[model samples]
Target: MENCPFCKIIERRLPADIIYENDRILVFKDINPAAPVHFLIVPKQHIPTLSDCHEGHTAILGEMMAVVPRIADMQKIGVVGSTPETRTGGYRVIINAGPDGRQEVYHLHVHMIGGPRPWKDNK
Candidate 1:
Protein backbone atom coordinates (compact mmCIF):
# COMPACT_ATOMS: atom_id res chain seq x y z
CA MET A 1 0.00 0.00 0.00
CA GLU A 2 2.92 2.30 0.70
CA ASN A 3 4.12 2.32 -2.88
CA CYS A 4 0.70 2.27 -4.48
CA PRO A 5 0.20 5.08 -7.00
CA PHE A 6 -3.33 5.89 -5.87
CA CYS A 7 -2.14 5.99 -2.29
CA LYS A 8 0.64 8.30 -3.37
CA ILE A 9 -1.87 10.54 -5.08
CA ILE A 10 -4.04 10.52 -1.96
CA GLU A 11 -1.06 11.31 0.20
CA ARG A 12 0.04 14.16 -2.03
CA ARG A 13 3.23 12.25 -2.79
CA LEU A 14 2.36 12.27 -6.50
CA PRO A 15 0.60 14.80 -8.66
CA ALA A 16 -2.87 14.24 -10.12
CA ASP A 17 -5.21 16.29 -12.29
CA ILE A 18 -7.77 16.31 -9.49
CA ILE A 19 -11.27 17.38 -10.51
CA TYR A 20 -13.11 16.50 -7.34
CA GLU A 21 -12.36 15.39 -3.81
CA ASN A 22 -13.90 14.93 -0.37
CA ASP A 23 -13.27 13.01 2.84
CA ARG A 24 -14.34 9.70 1.29
CA ILE A 25 -13.23 9.87 -2.36
CA LEU A 26 -11.01 11.47 -4.97
CA VAL A 27 -11.70 12.02 -8.65
CA PHE A 28 -9.04 12.85 -11.17
CA LYS A 29 -8.29 12.71 -14.88
CA ASP A 30 -6.61 9.59 -16.18
CA ILE A 31 -2.98 9.92 -17.20
CA ASN A 32 -3.81 7.98 -20.39
CA PRO A 33 -7.36 8.83 -21.32
CA ALA A 34 -9.49 6.34 -23.21
CA ALA A 35 -12.19 8.81 -24.24
CA PRO A 36 -12.80 12.53 -24.56
CA VAL A 37 -13.72 12.46 -20.90
CA HIS A 38 -11.82 9.80 -18.96
CA PHE A 39 -11.36 10.16 -15.26
CA LEU A 40 -10.73 7.96 -12.24
CA ILE A 41 -12.75 7.68 -9.05
CA VAL A 42 -10.95 6.19 -6.07
CA PRO A 43 -11.52 5.85 -2.36
CA LYS A 44 -9.26 7.57 0.12
CA GLN A 45 -8.68 4.15 1.68
CA HIS A 46 -6.51 1.58 -0.05
CA ILE A 47 -8.44 -1.47 -1.14
CA PRO A 48 -6.14 -3.30 -3.53
CA THR A 49 -8.73 -4.71 -5.91
CA LEU A 50 -12.46 -4.92 -6.42
CA SER A 51 -12.31 -8.50 -5.21
CA ASP A 52 -10.97 -7.27 -1.92
CA CYS A 53 -14.05 -5.30 -1.09
CA HIS A 54 -16.37 -6.74 1.57
CA GLU A 55 -19.66 -5.84 3.23
CA GLY A 56 -17.89 -3.25 5.34
CA HIS A 57 -17.07 -1.39 2.16
CA THR A 58 -20.70 -0.92 1.24
CA ALA A 59 -21.01 2.70 2.21
CA ILE A 60 -17.84 3.72 0.44
CA LEU A 61 -18.93 1.81 -2.60
CA GLY A 62 -22.32 3.44 -2.48
CA GLU A 63 -20.76 6.85 -2.17
CA MET A 64 -18.53 6.03 -5.12
CA MET A 65 -21.52 5.11 -7.27
CA ALA A 66 -23.43 8.16 -6.09
CA VAL A 67 -20.63 10.49 -7.17
CA VAL A 68 -20.65 9.23 -10.77
CA PRO A 69 -23.83 11.01 -11.82
CA ARG A 70 -22.68 14.21 -10.16
CA ILE A 71 -19.42 14.03 -12.05
CA ALA A 72 -21.34 13.31 -15.24
CA ASP A 73 -23.49 16.34 -14.60
CA MET A 74 -20.42 18.48 -13.99
CA GLN A 75 -18.78 17.22 -17.16
CA LYS A 76 -21.98 17.84 -19.13
CA ILE A 77 -21.77 14.27 -20.34
CA GLY A 78 -25.06 12.90 -19.06
CA VAL A 79 -28.74 13.69 -19.41
CA VAL A 80 -28.69 16.69 -21.74
CA GLY A 81 -32.40 16.26 -22.58
CA SER A 82 -35.38 15.38 -20.45
CA THR A 83 -37.03 12.37 -22.12
CA PRO A 84 -35.40 9.09 -23.15
CA GLU A 85 -36.20 9.92 -26.78
CA THR A 86 -34.54 13.31 -26.41
CA ARG A 87 -31.54 12.14 -24.38
CA THR A 88 -28.35 12.95 -26.25
CA GLY A 89 -25.34 11.92 -24.12
CA GLY A 90 -24.30 9.36 -21.51
CA TYR A 91 -21.26 7.94 -19.70
CA ARG A 92 -19.37 4.70 -19.14
CA VAL A 93 -18.02 3.22 -15.91
CA ILE A 94 -15.20 0.67 -15.96
CA ILE A 95 -13.39 -1.20 -13.21
CA ASN A 96 -10.65 -3.58 -14.19
CA ALA A 97 -9.64 -6.08 -11.54
CA GLY A 98 -6.75 -8.52 -11.18
CA PRO A 99 -4.38 -9.81 -13.91
CA ASP A 100 -6.98 -11.05 -16.35
CA GLY A 101 -8.84 -7.75 -16.12
CA ARG A 102 -5.73 -5.84 -17.22
CA GLN A 103 -5.67 -3.67 -14.16
CA GLU A 104 -2.64 -1.41 -14.36
CA VAL A 105 -3.02 -0.23 -10.81
CA TYR A 106 -3.69 -2.55 -7.92
CA HIS A 107 -5.74 -0.02 -6.05
CA LEU A 108 -9.49 -0.39 -6.46
CA HIS A 109 -10.82 2.42 -8.62
CA VAL A 110 -13.49 3.21 -11.16
CA HIS A 111 -12.72 4.56 -14.60
CA MET A 112 -15.37 7.08 -15.68
CA ILE A 113 -15.24 7.39 -19.46
CA GLY A 114 -17.58 9.49 -21.54
CA GLY A 115 -18.05 12.57 -23.72
CA PRO A 116 -18.72 13.07 -27.45
CA ARG A 117 -15.87 10.97 -28.82
CA PRO A 118 -15.44 7.26 -29.45
CA TRP A 119 -14.36 5.18 -26.46
CA LYS A 120 -10.88 3.81 -26.98
CA ASP A 121 -9.44 0.52 -25.70
CA ASN A 122 -8.80 1.42 -22.07
CA LYS A 123 -5.43 0.36 -20.73
Candidate 2:
Protein backbone atom coordinates (compact mmCIF):
# COMPACT_ATOMS: atom_id res chain seq x y z
CA MET A 1 0.00 0.00 0.00
CA GLU A 2 3.03 2.25 0.32
CA ASN A 3 3.22 2.80 -3.43
CA CYS A 4 -0.48 2.76 -4.25
CA PRO A 5 -1.47 5.81 -6.24
CA PHE A 6 -4.93 5.79 -4.75
CA CYS A 7 -3.45 5.68 -1.30
CA LYS A 8 -1.36 8.71 -2.13
CA ILE A 9 -4.44 10.49 -3.36
CA ILE A 10 -6.20 9.58 -0.16
CA GLU A 11 -3.26 10.81 1.82
CA ARG A 12 -3.13 14.05 -0.12
CA ARG A 13 0.20 13.12 -1.60
CA LEU A 14 -1.18 13.17 -5.17
CA PRO A 15 -3.66 15.26 -7.04
CA ALA A 16 -7.03 13.86 -8.10
CA ASP A 17 -10.16 15.41 -9.48
CA ILE A 18 -12.16 14.28 -6.51
CA ILE A 19 -15.89 14.72 -6.75
CA TYR A 20 -17.12 13.15 -3.56
CA GLU A 21 -15.60 12.07 -0.30
CA ASN A 22 -17.10 10.56 2.81
CA ASP A 23 -15.71 8.92 5.90
CA ARG A 24 -15.77 5.51 4.25
CA ILE A 25 -15.18 6.12 0.55
CA LEU A 26 -13.81 8.51 -2.02
CA VAL A 27 -15.27 9.26 -5.43
CA PHE A 28 -13.38 10.84 -8.28
CA LYS A 29 -13.43 11.21 -12.04
CA ASP A 30 -11.64 8.59 -14.05
CA ILE A 31 -8.45 9.84 -15.71
CA ASN A 32 -9.12 7.92 -18.91
CA PRO A 33 -12.83 7.91 -19.32
CA ALA A 34 -14.57 5.28 -21.43
CA ALA A 35 -17.94 7.01 -21.46
CA PRO A 36 -19.54 10.42 -21.47
CA VAL A 37 -19.48 10.29 -17.67
CA HIS A 38 -17.21 8.06 -15.69
CA PHE A 39 -15.96 8.01 -12.09
CA LEU A 40 -14.57 5.62 -9.57
CA ILE A 41 -16.04 4.98 -6.12
CA VAL A 42 -13.27 3.65 -3.98
CA PRO A 43 -13.40 2.37 -0.45
CA LYS A 44 -11.03 3.94 2.02
CA GLN A 45 -10.02 0.46 3.00
CA HIS A 46 -7.44 -0.97 0.68
CA ILE A 47 -9.19 -4.03 -0.58
CA PRO A 48 -7.46 -5.77 -3.45
CA THR A 49 -10.58 -7.26 -5.04
CA LEU A 50 -14.12 -8.40 -4.47
CA SER A 51 -12.91 -11.94 -4.07
CA ASP A 52 -10.83 -10.81 -1.14
CA CYS A 53 -13.90 -9.72 0.79
CA HIS A 54 -15.10 -11.66 3.78
CA GLU A 55 -17.85 -11.44 6.35
CA GLY A 56 -16.21 -8.48 8.00
CA HIS A 57 -16.51 -6.56 4.76
CA THR A 58 -20.27 -6.77 4.61
CA ALA A 59 -21.02 -3.30 5.98
CA ILE A 60 -18.40 -1.56 3.89
CA LEU A 61 -19.60 -3.29 0.74
CA GLY A 62 -23.15 -2.35 1.52
CA GLU A 63 -22.17 1.24 2.13
CA MET A 64 -20.35 1.32 -1.19
CA MET A 65 -23.47 0.22 -3.08
CA ALA A 66 -25.83 2.50 -1.17
CA VAL A 67 -24.30 5.64 -2.67
CA VAL A 68 -24.58 4.76 -6.36
CA PRO A 69 -27.83 6.60 -6.98
CA ARG A 70 -26.60 9.63 -5.07
CA ILE A 71 -23.50 9.82 -7.23
CA ALA A 72 -25.59 9.43 -10.38
CA ASP A 73 -27.88 12.22 -9.28
CA MET A 74 -24.95 14.49 -8.46
CA GLN A 75 -23.66 13.97 -11.98
CA LYS A 76 -27.19 14.84 -13.22
CA ILE A 77 -27.60 11.34 -14.56
CA GLY A 78 -31.26 10.42 -14.89
CA VAL A 79 -33.08 7.47 -13.47
CA VAL A 80 -33.42 4.02 -15.02
CA GLY A 81 -37.10 3.67 -15.77
CA SER A 82 -38.43 0.16 -16.06
CA THR A 83 -40.94 0.81 -18.87
CA PRO A 84 -40.27 2.13 -22.34
CA GLU A 85 -42.60 5.07 -21.79
CA THR A 86 -41.00 5.87 -18.44
CA ARG A 87 -37.43 5.16 -19.42
CA THR A 88 -34.92 7.90 -18.66
CA GLY A 89 -31.34 8.53 -17.49
CA GLY A 90 -28.79 5.77 -17.09
CA TYR A 91 -25.58 4.61 -15.48
CA ARG A 92 -23.45 1.48 -15.07
CA VAL A 93 -21.36 0.05 -12.25
CA ILE A 94 -18.44 -2.26 -12.89
CA ILE A 95 -16.06 -4.14 -10.61
CA ASN A 96 -13.07 -5.85 -12.13
CA ALA A 97 -11.18 -8.55 -10.28
CA GLY A 98 -7.75 -10.08 -10.68
CA PRO A 99 -5.84 -10.17 -13.95
CA ASP A 100 -8.50 -11.96 -15.97
CA GLY A 101 -10.97 -9.21 -15.12
CA ARG A 102 -8.70 -6.55 -16.65
CA GLN A 103 -8.24 -4.68 -13.41
CA GLU A 104 -5.46 -2.14 -13.88
CA VAL A 105 -5.33 -1.18 -10.21
CA TYR A 106 -4.91 -3.60 -7.36
CA HIS A 107 -7.21 -1.64 -5.06
CA LEU A 108 -10.85 -2.65 -5.14
CA HIS A 109 -13.14 0.00 -6.60
CA VAL A 110 -16.41 0.47 -8.42
CA HIS A 111 -16.69 2.17 -11.79
CA MET A 112 -19.84 4.16 -12.42
CA ILE A 113 -20.40 5.28 -16.01
CA GLY A 114 -23.33 6.76 -17.86
CA GLY A 115 -24.73 9.49 -20.08
CA PRO A 116 -25.23 9.46 -23.91
CA ARG A 117 -23.56 6.69 -25.82
CA PRO A 118 -20.94 7.06 -28.55
CA TRP A 119 -19.15 9.64 -26.48
CA LYS A 120 -17.62 12.16 -28.83
CA ASP A 121 -13.90 12.71 -28.68
CA ASN A 122 -13.64 15.81 -26.51
CA LYS A 123 -9.97 16.30 -27.14
Candidate 3:
Protein backbone atom coordinates (compact mmCIF):
# COMPACT_ATOMS: atom_id res chain seq x y z
CA MET A 1 0.00 0.00 0.00
CA GLU A 2 3.04 2.24 -0.22
CA ASN A 3 1.93 3.61 -3.56
CA CYS A 4 -1.73 3.96 -2.67
CA PRO A 5 -2.82 7.59 -2.95
CA PHE A 6 -5.49 7.41 -0.26
CA CYS A 7 -3.08 5.67 2.10
CA LYS A 8 -0.73 8.56 1.50
CA ILE A 9 -3.51 10.97 2.31
CA ILE A 10 -4.37 9.13 5.51
CA GLU A 11 -0.71 9.16 6.44
CA ARG A 12 -0.57 12.92 5.84
CA ARG A 13 1.91 12.38 3.07
CA LEU A 14 -0.51 13.84 0.51
CA PRO A 15 -2.86 16.77 0.50
CA ALA A 16 -6.63 16.63 0.50
CA ASP A 17 -9.46 19.07 1.23
CA ILE A 18 -10.05 17.41 4.57
CA ILE A 19 -13.22 18.32 6.41
CA TYR A 20 -13.14 16.01 9.39
CA GLU A 21 -10.68 13.77 11.12
CA ASN A 22 -10.63 11.59 14.16
CA ASP A 23 -8.55 8.82 15.62
CA ARG A 24 -10.42 6.30 13.50
CA ILE A 25 -11.63 8.10 10.39
CA LEU A 26 -11.04 10.93 7.93
CA VAL A 27 -13.44 12.86 5.73
CA PHE A 28 -12.54 15.00 2.76
CA LYS A 29 -13.97 16.61 -0.32
CA ASP A 30 -13.57 14.59 -3.49
CA ILE A 31 -11.34 16.33 -6.03
CA ASN A 32 -13.56 15.21 -8.88
CA PRO A 33 -17.09 15.64 -7.67
CA ALA A 34 -20.04 13.99 -9.39
CA ALA A 35 -22.48 16.27 -7.56
CA PRO A 36 -22.39 19.85 -6.34
CA VAL A 37 -21.52 18.45 -2.93
CA HIS A 38 -19.34 15.37 -2.88
CA PHE A 39 -17.03 14.02 -0.24
CA LEU A 40 -15.30 10.84 0.81
CA ILE A 41 -15.33 9.18 4.21
CA VAL A 42 -12.51 6.79 4.87
CA PRO A 43 -11.15 4.74 7.73
CA LYS A 44 -7.76 5.47 9.22
CA GLN A 45 -6.82 1.85 8.81
CA HIS A 46 -6.39 0.64 5.27
CA ILE A 47 -9.00 -1.85 4.14
CA PRO A 48 -9.41 -2.61 0.47
CA THR A 49 -13.20 -2.92 0.50
CA LEU A 50 -16.25 -4.02 2.45
CA SER A 51 -15.57 -7.51 1.20
CA ASP A 52 -12.29 -7.40 3.10
CA CYS A 53 -13.87 -6.34 6.35
CA HIS A 54 -13.90 -8.58 9.43
CA GLU A 55 -16.02 -8.76 12.57
CA GLY A 56 -13.64 -6.45 14.42
CA HIS A 57 -14.43 -3.71 11.89
CA THR A 58 -18.12 -3.64 12.69
CA ALA A 59 -17.98 -0.97 15.40
CA ILE A 60 -15.92 1.36 13.32
CA LEU A 61 -18.23 0.84 10.37
CA GLY A 62 -21.20 1.55 12.59
CA GLU A 63 -19.60 4.73 13.83
CA MET A 64 -19.02 5.84 10.27
CA MET A 65 -22.62 5.16 9.33
CA ALA A 66 -23.93 6.98 12.40
CA VAL A 67 -21.83 10.01 11.55
CA VAL A 68 -23.00 10.38 7.98
CA PRO A 69 -26.15 12.31 8.87
CA ARG A 70 -24.27 14.70 11.09
CA ILE A 71 -21.68 15.29 8.43
CA ALA A 72 -24.34 15.85 5.77
CA ASP A 73 -26.12 18.33 8.00
CA MET A 74 -22.91 20.21 8.56
CA GLN A 75 -22.47 20.38 4.78
CA LYS A 76 -26.05 21.60 4.39
CA ILE A 77 -26.92 18.59 2.31
CA GLY A 78 -29.16 16.80 4.78
CA VAL A 79 -32.85 16.43 3.99
CA VAL A 80 -34.10 17.75 7.30
CA GLY A 81 -34.11 21.50 7.94
CA SER A 82 -32.66 22.22 4.52
CA THR A 83 -34.27 24.89 2.37
CA PRO A 84 -36.40 23.65 -0.48
CA GLU A 85 -34.76 23.92 -3.92
CA THR A 86 -31.50 24.76 -2.26
CA ARG A 87 -29.34 21.94 -3.46
CA THR A 88 -30.54 19.42 -0.87
CA GLY A 89 -33.06 17.55 -2.93
CA GLY A 90 -31.66 14.50 -1.21
CA TYR A 91 -28.34 12.77 -1.20
CA ARG A 92 -26.89 9.47 -2.24
CA VAL A 93 -24.30 7.44 -0.42
CA ILE A 94 -22.22 5.08 -2.49
CA ILE A 95 -19.35 2.68 -1.94
CA ASN A 96 -17.75 1.36 -5.08
CA ALA A 97 -15.48 -1.62 -4.60
CA GLY A 98 -12.77 -2.87 -6.92
CA PRO A 99 -12.32 -2.26 -10.68
CA ASP A 100 -15.64 -3.73 -11.65
CA GLY A 101 -17.37 -1.12 -9.48
CA ARG A 102 -15.21 1.72 -10.85
CA GLN A 103 -13.26 2.24 -7.66
CA GLU A 104 -10.22 4.31 -8.48
CA VAL A 105 -8.77 4.23 -5.02
CA TYR A 106 -7.89 0.88 -3.51
CA HIS A 107 -8.67 2.06 -0.01
CA LEU A 108 -12.16 1.42 1.28
CA HIS A 109 -14.27 4.58 1.33
CA VAL A 110 -17.81 5.86 1.13
CA HIS A 111 -18.93 8.62 -1.19
CA MET A 112 -21.58 11.03 -0.04
CA ILE A 113 -23.12 13.09 -2.82
CA GLY A 114 -25.86 15.68 -2.83
CA GLY A 115 -27.16 18.84 -4.57
CA PRO A 116 -28.85 18.69 -7.95
CA ARG A 117 -28.62 15.30 -9.58
CA PRO A 118 -26.51 15.62 -12.68
CA TRP A 119 -28.08 15.34 -16.13
CA LYS A 120 -28.36 11.76 -17.27
CA ASP A 121 -26.25 12.51 -20.33
CA ASN A 122 -23.43 13.99 -18.28
CA LYS A 123 -21.83 10.65 -17.44
Candidate 4:
Protein backbone atom coordinates (compact mmCIF):
# COMPACT_ATOMS: atom_id res chain seq x y z
CA MET A 1 0.00 0.00 0.00
CA GLU A 2 2.98 2.27 0.49
CA ASN A 3 3.33 2.67 -3.24
CA CYS A 4 -0.38 3.22 -3.83
CA PRO A 5 -0.80 6.74 -5.10
CA PHE A 6 -4.25 7.24 -3.60
CA CYS A 7 -3.05 5.99 -0.23
CA LYS A 8 -0.24 8.51 -0.37
CA ILE A 9 -2.76 11.24 -1.07
CA ILE A 10 -4.96 10.11 1.78
CA GLU A 11 -1.94 10.00 4.09
CA ARG A 12 -0.82 13.46 3.03
CA ARG A 13 2.34 11.93 1.53
CA LEU A 14 1.19 13.36 -1.80
CA PRO A 15 -0.81 16.42 -2.84
CA ALA A 16 -4.10 16.42 -4.74
CA ASP A 17 -6.76 18.92 -5.63
CA ILE A 18 -9.06 17.51 -3.02
CA ILE A 19 -12.72 18.44 -3.35
CA TYR A 20 -14.07 16.52 -0.41
CA GLU A 21 -12.82 14.36 2.44
CA ASN A 22 -14.27 12.63 5.44
CA ASP A 23 -13.26 9.85 7.78
CA ARG A 24 -14.31 7.24 5.22
CA ILE A 25 -13.63 8.73 1.80
CA LEU A 26 -11.59 11.20 -0.22
CA VAL A 27 -12.53 12.97 -3.46
CA PHE A 28 -10.05 14.76 -5.64
CA LYS A 29 -9.55 16.05 -9.17
CA ASP A 30 -7.97 13.56 -11.52
CA ILE A 31 -4.50 14.63 -12.64
CA ASN A 32 -5.15 13.50 -16.20
CA PRO A 33 -8.76 14.38 -16.74
CA ALA A 34 -10.80 12.75 -19.47
CA ALA A 35 -13.48 15.45 -19.29
CA PRO A 36 -13.63 19.11 -18.49
CA VAL A 37 -14.70 18.08 -15.04
CA HIS A 38 -13.17 14.81 -13.98
CA PHE A 39 -12.55 13.71 -10.43
CA LEU A 40 -11.78 10.52 -8.58
CA ILE A 41 -13.68 9.34 -5.54
CA VAL A 42 -11.77 6.87 -3.38
CA PRO A 43 -12.19 5.17 -0.05
CA LYS A 44 -9.79 6.05 2.71
CA GLN A 45 -9.01 2.40 3.21
CA HIS A 46 -6.71 0.56 0.83
CA ILE A 47 -8.88 -1.74 -1.24
CA PRO A 48 -7.02 -2.85 -4.37
CA THR A 49 -10.11 -3.04 -6.52
CA LEU A 50 -13.80 -3.97 -6.54
CA SER A 51 -12.71 -7.59 -6.87
CA ASP A 52 -11.05 -7.34 -3.48
CA CYS A 53 -14.20 -6.19 -1.74
CA HIS A 54 -15.71 -8.38 0.94
CA GLU A 55 -19.00 -8.47 2.82
CA GLY A 56 -17.48 -6.24 5.46
CA HIS A 57 -17.16 -3.57 2.80
CA THR A 58 -20.88 -3.37 2.05
CA ALA A 59 -21.68 -0.52 4.37
CA ILE A 60 -18.77 1.52 3.17
CA LEU A 61 -19.68 0.83 -0.42
CA GLY A 62 -23.23 1.89 0.29
CA GLU A 63 -22.03 5.08 1.84
CA MET A 64 -19.80 5.77 -1.13
CA MET A 65 -22.65 5.18 -3.57
CA ALA A 66 -25.01 7.34 -1.56
CA VAL A 67 -22.55 10.19 -1.67
CA VAL A 68 -21.76 10.15 -5.37
CA PRO A 69 -24.79 12.15 -6.41
CA ARG A 70 -24.27 14.69 -3.65
CA ILE A 71 -20.64 15.10 -4.59
CA ALA A 72 -21.55 15.37 -8.26
CA ASP A 73 -23.93 18.18 -7.43
CA MET A 74 -21.28 19.94 -5.39
CA GLN A 75 -18.90 19.65 -8.31
CA LYS A 76 -21.54 21.23 -10.58
CA ILE A 77 -21.63 18.04 -12.62
CA GLY A 78 -25.23 17.13 -11.92
CA VAL A 79 -28.63 18.45 -10.84
CA VAL A 80 -27.54 21.91 -9.77
CA GLY A 81 -29.77 23.81 -12.12
CA SER A 82 -32.37 23.46 -14.88
CA THR A 83 -30.82 25.23 -17.84
CA PRO A 84 -30.22 22.95 -20.83
CA GLU A 85 -26.90 24.68 -21.39
CA THR A 86 -25.72 23.93 -17.88
CA ARG A 87 -23.01 21.33 -17.55
CA THR A 88 -24.62 19.92 -14.43
CA GLY A 89 -27.53 18.37 -16.30
CA GLY A 90 -25.70 15.33 -17.57
CA TYR A 91 -22.58 13.54 -16.46
CA ARG A 92 -21.06 10.12 -16.45
CA VAL A 93 -20.07 8.13 -13.40
CA ILE A 94 -17.56 5.38 -14.11
CA ILE A 95 -15.69 2.81 -12.08
CA ASN A 96 -12.92 0.96 -13.83
CA ALA A 97 -12.27 -2.36 -12.14
CA GLY A 98 -8.81 -3.46 -13.30
CA PRO A 99 -6.10 -3.29 -15.93
CA ASP A 100 -8.48 -4.45 -18.64
CA GLY A 101 -10.86 -1.68 -17.65
CA ARG A 102 -8.21 1.01 -18.04
CA GLN A 103 -7.67 1.44 -14.36
CA GLU A 104 -4.25 2.96 -13.91
CA VAL A 105 -4.43 3.15 -10.14
CA TYR A 106 -4.67 -0.09 -8.24
CA HIS A 107 -6.87 1.47 -5.58
CA LEU A 108 -10.60 1.35 -6.05
CA HIS A 109 -12.04 4.66 -7.21
CA VAL A 110 -14.90 6.08 -9.26
CA HIS A 111 -14.42 8.64 -11.95
CA MET A 112 -17.01 11.44 -12.19
CA ILE A 113 -16.95 13.20 -15.54
CA GLY A 114 -18.94 16.05 -17.12
CA GLY A 115 -18.83 19.69 -18.23
CA PRO A 116 -18.06 20.99 -21.72
CA ARG A 117 -18.70 18.59 -24.61
CA PRO A 118 -19.91 15.02 -24.58
CA TRP A 119 -17.27 12.33 -24.05
CA LYS A 120 -15.38 12.11 -27.34
CA ASP A 121 -16.41 8.57 -28.15
CA ASN A 122 -20.07 9.36 -27.52
CA LYS A 123 -19.95 11.80 -30.38
Point to the candidate with the largest TM-score: 1
lDDT, model 2, position 120: 46
Cα error of candidate 1 at position 51, Å: 0.4
Candidate 1 positional error at 15, Å = 0.5
lDDT of 3 by residue, 1-123 (tens): 899888899898999999999999999999988888889999988898888999999988887787788888889878864556553346778889888998888888999888766733244
TM-score per candidate, chains pooled: 0.95, 0.91, 0.87, 0.87
* lDDT leaderboard ranking: 1, 2, 4, 3
Task: Give the clash count for model 2.
Answer: 0
Instruction: Compute the lDDT for candidate 2.
Output: 0.88
- For every model shown, the clashing-pair count is 0, 0, 0, 0
Model 4, 1-123: lDDT tens digits are: 989999999999999999998899999999988788888989999999998999999988888888888887787767665666753465788888888987889999988888878665553
Which 10-residue window in model 3 sums to the lowest lDDT?
Answer: 81-90
Per-candidate Cα lDDT values, in order, are 0.92, 0.88, 0.85, 0.86
* Cα lDDT of model 1 by residue, 1-123, tens digit: 888999999999999999999999999999998899999999999999999999999999999999999999999887688887988988898899999998999999999999876567643
**1-123: candidate 2 lDDT, tens digit per residue:** 998888878888989999999999999999999888999988988998999999999998998889999999889885967899998988888999999998999888999888887664432
> Which sequence of candidate numbers ranks them by TM-score, best first?
1, 2, 4, 3
Estimate the lDDT of model 1. Answer: 0.92
